[model samples]
Target: MEAAMSTPGRGLTWSLRGRGPADVPVVADPGPWPPDSGGPAATGRGVRVCVVDSGVERDHPAVGRVDGSWVVVKDPDTGETSVRPTETGDSCGHGTACAGIVRRTAPECELHSVRVLGERFSGTGDVLLAGLRWAVEQGFDLVNLSLSTTRDRFARELHELADQAYFARTVIVASAHNTPVESFPWRFASVISVGSHQEDDPGLHLYNPSPPVEFFAPGQNVPVPWLGGATIRTTGNSFATPYITGLCARLLSAHPSMTAFQLKNALYLSAANVRFRSLPSLPAGEASDESSESDEPGELHRSRESPEPPEPRLAAGADGTGN
Candidate 1:
């Protein structure tokens, strides 16, 4: 029997036991609820996604039609926070890169940008929380947070917000920190956490039989839009995260009322490595069979190497986690 572990809010997220690449085999059985990424099914027509990063460049061709823009403002004197509309663009190109990935994956999804990181990608932990709270309150279908806080003090607040997003059906797709260090939101079971994979196929993603980081997507040497409508190749878990976010948007667009948990299940079943024991049709707005869902994952096989540390940026650390 495969081993399983439970998480807060989310129960028995992983149903199998495997560590690293060799242990997780690729079974050919198609899962009961296979994730469909066919062209017509998921264009992200009706989904709303909030990119909470440095900020997204307006009309950068790659990231077209940003429906709204907001910034988290902190009172330098009182240290209070508020969210306001902004005409500003990306501060250090990170947010634009993430936003561009989402656009490429799900072209029709409504995109919104909220600037939590400023010039040189410098911002505080409180500011991160404020921006995240605002994004969650907006009821956005998905929030792509490529940044995180390493401070233990901020963990509880981030967890609460993650739970809030989970129960509200506002799925939060967060990136696992580039280093093996501890971080927020992404570590929370209530959120869909992602890490990077070394694969040429952008369409490929795999489920780990382990816990903590749930899925691995494309995040190495990715071609993405940068400042001034320029394109650059970058590598990091940050880039891989939007790949999952884009998928979530597409899934939600197809299944309009899918909760974060349900959407995550579809992602798991859709994973290239998942093997189906029996093909069971899932009712709309429900999870797959008995906690673990599909049988032990063993489908498509690929390189599962842990991504190296992200390339260094010129800025002062990422916005949020103090450098």
Candidate 2:
């Protein structure tokens, strides 16, 4: 069932290349918010994570204990997409790789998979939409979208879906296009878009004071699970996305009630780049938009003291459009 596939972009660069770590201000106080990514005890035990990709292998050593699996099928004559349970495992090893990363980061989180791509990552935009819609409807704590469509025709619908999920409190962690290009879902403000850093530390994540891409994680030449119970090292914005997703899972484990807005705020506060001063009070636990429908109650600001090199910009969502 392989078809022409959307290519995963490679080499997303968001780094302050020349500056040493000491130069950048490190603020340990991530506001008065509940513990987030750096929470030492949170292992994502109660979180339910959905990996919407080419499907995940059930018993792969690197990706142990998958909770569930599904595949999106399209009827040839009707051209409609639908979900069905499957035990066949990964079609292109992409989903397994992503699941493995999530497992490594959030070992206790229940991992689920929804296959939306075929071998070589071949898939259609409609299927991507269908799989994502189902994943969102399930109300999973976090959904990882490591794949995206570059087509402008799908943008509006995808944006709507992303927003819908945002309001539903189904936090979506999407990958930025590996290259500098227009991509859906990631560009929207509703989803937490991620890019890659070359750092070997899987636990190290950075906040992009600048975005379409909001966060950066380990993605370059990352060692991940492949097909046939083997291990392979690969790199792409896709890999980086799951790392952020896992972090989101950990955050949710600790808070258990944080909304998408507060989750994102937590991320911004925990970001290694930001100089955390006493942050303004945020809504303790507002579920949805309030009196006015907008991104947030007020703008979230980051303080950058002088003499520090500018934050590096690479990875998904670095479109610079601020959309």
Q: Which model scores highest in lDDT?
A: 1
How many clashes (backbone N, Cα, C below 3 Å) per candidate?
A: 4, 5
C-alpha positional error of residue 225 in candidate 1 after TM-score superposition, expressed in Å: 0.4
Off by over 4 Å in 1: 1-40, 119-123, 278-323
Local accuracy of candidate 2 as per-residue lDDT tens digits, 96-183: 9999998887778999999998833344588898899999999999999998898888888888888889978899999999989888
Candidate 2 structure lDDT = 0.77
- Candidate 2 backbone collisions, by pair: 13-314, 14-314, 176-316, 212-317, 213-317
Residue 191 of model 2 has an lDDT of 98
* Candidate 1 residue-wise lDDT, 1-323, digit = tens: 11213333344325454566566664431212222423234568889999999999988999999999999888777988889999999988999999999999888899999999883333458889989999999999999999999888899989988988898889999999999899897999999999998998877888878969999999999999999999999999999999889888776655565667666776775676654454445779876766444444553233323221121111001111110
Worst ten in a row by lDDT for model 1: 314-323
- The TM-score between candidate 2 and the true structure equals 0.73
TM-score of each: 0.74, 0.73
Candidate 2: C-alpha RMSD after superposition: 15.3
